[model samples]
Target: MDLDSLTLAYAYGCRNAGDFAINEGSLALLDRTVPDVDVTAVSRFASESPEYERMVEELDGVEDGALVGGPITYDPESQSRPAQLAALARNGLQYGVDVAGVADDLSVHSALYEGITDADAMLFNGGNAIHYSPSHGNLPYLLAMLYPLQVARRNDVPYGLLPQTTFALEGVARRLVVPLLEDAEFVMTRDAITFDYLSEFGLSTQLINGVDTAFLNGTPTAGDPSDGESNRIAAVPRFSTLGDTGELDAAGKRMEDTFLTYLDRLVDAGDEVTLTIQTEIDAAWAERNRDRLDDIGVGYYESYDPDELRAHYAEMDLLVTMRLHAAIFALSVGTPTIGVYRPEWGPKMDGTFRTLDIAEYAIPWDGATVETLEAATADALDEGRALSQHVADNVSLRNEALVSDLRTALSTADGFA
Candidate 1:
């Protein structure tokens, strides 16, 4: 039962909030299910700046893992980047970096299949697909950058994708990833467009729509639901992409203007309007949004520990978000969530908003005119409370099932080697 005997690897955009949610979710799941295993986390993408330094530091002590760099840069012409990733992968495998915490019994583990078992239950944890932004190339080390996933597959190791978005493969890139998806144990995207695109490409994947990992346990507001005084909706301003140079401050200003306009139209609309901040790597962005708020809001879970964060989500009456994890946290409390889908990277919208029963709640990223957003918001506010209750009753059970599937995937009895 030594907590430091198991090992694992993850892929993430540490800059994004979803990465934080995924890590914390895995940790919670681990602590509850896995009796005694040391978890190792390695950050894939990083820079030499102080902010980057803070990020890596924040992820401290979570995993007994190593963080290695990749040489394969995303731009197809950046030959050095890919080569570096390949070298890192080879070096890591050669050095047995992934086997750092397998206790004495499973120390020699290195195969794909051979699922483990403890007592009568199978240990369902193994090499997992780092669910993240396909738009962000630096972290993943590019398409087909490493064959470990393939290796894990060959060994019969189960691969579970933690709430990932999608990218439409075109030309040679598309040609390469099809077979990879074909072999994945399970692939769940964050939006419908991604689900549809991957399906169009012939990957018959399940479409179990859910919010970001961050939403696993967000809080709710307590302004007295009995009085109907706090019947309001919440939203995060839209900003940033995995590979964009857009100024978040400017985006914040635009959100402020848009929010005010959105509110003016709802002067007597029964729902109070408010704003919250969801950050990826941009602290400045969250701060900018906070500055623009009406001196009071919920869903601002920054700089808070997981317990406090969960409490914050419990306080919300209704939640709407541009950030994926924000949706998850709200959903964790059975709060109705609206997921925004921008059009430029239409594929990124794959799983988040492509969900059935909630299609009317989705705001098309490219088509978010105030009128449409307001109209949708108005309708959602009317239906939201009941929707939240329904999710708390129905959807929460489905969420538990996903966790069960994950547990089955991570059974830890025998050797994965």
Candidate 2:
């Protein structure tokens, strides 16, 4: 079949710069392997982004559609939590959390629904679209993300997923989503942990081990280093220290204090430090810690454009970030990056670092100290050149494999080649 004749429906929701980077990378991958293809992006907030508008017109004529019949509520004691846990436990989820809000129905945007049903093929772009969260079981979020793909499935249209992170899944949630995943023509996971998680399902789809596509979307630029002076550093902090409840509990307070103390030390050492905000979540955390940040007197860099954000990372001599994509952008451009992460999300960060054989640089936020941060940051700076080359080579190799696999998947999709 002629590639140009293909109408590829790309489903994504941009909530952060990482989301934008993933979308950019998805488009780049398609451009490389399926040039001139007709692409339509399905986003609920299409009106908010020109990039989304350029690919597909703003969403209109949305319909209130119900997929399942049940009560929807946030109360963990509701029948939904236990039922979901029981289902997932049978499928291999050992210990599941019950914080995710329940959703019995989906508000279907007409454009997204029709885009999948009428398109020649569809692909769900990457992120943590399918995952179990400790704070929220993610059932409602999962339904919203899966609604488009479900439409494609019901219409007998072929679909696939790009590289995505998978944290957790269980009972009712697993039962509802796993079948669709198993039936995909192709599915690629962004990390080994996710790949292994999916392996337990014994999916018939061709499962490919892939890296985050955002690594491919970056344009590396080597910045000038400080000549024997304090290094220029950019830190992208997340609200993970506060846990899912968003309350400043004892442990959470300790983590936050350690982080702030580390920053204070950085400032004391005369390093040209700056706070970088890559998402609304990061912005909120900054606001929460406004007084602390002000006392430290560090500068701030904020932007929503993926490429612009990448350029910002490229300019930094060293990047200390809790945001996964911030580290991704910095490493792609050869900047030394130290990832500060919590266990709930650390697996994904560690998986990315492991790809480049730099897992040591991904630090655990729990029991972390100013000394640990200093040690990791110092080590990363010392091995900057080697780390950069390692990342570049690994990303190049993975990107080639991704494109080849995507080409094969597209060629073999039902009613395609």
Evaluated with TM-score, which candidate comes out highest?
2
lDDT of 1 by residue, 267-366 (tens): 3455555455445444566565454443443333453244443445556666667755556666666666677655543444334434524566766654
User: Which 10-residue window in model 1 sums to the lowest lDDT?
Assistant: 112-121
Q: Summarize candidate 2's per-residue lDDT along 83-154 as a digit string, tens digits.
A: 656644532211111112112144323445555555677787787677655455466556656665676676
Candidate 2 weakest lDDT stretch, 10 residues: 93-102
Candidate with the greatest lDDT versus the true structure: 2
Each model's TM-score? 0.64, 0.80
TM-score of candidate 1 relative to the true fold: 0.64
After best superposition, candidate 2 residue 239: deviation in angstroms? 0.7
> Model 2 residue 41 lDDT?
58
* 26: Cα error in model 2, Å: 0.9
RMSD of 1: 7.8
Q: Candidate 2, after superposition: displacement of residue 122 in Å?
A: 0.8
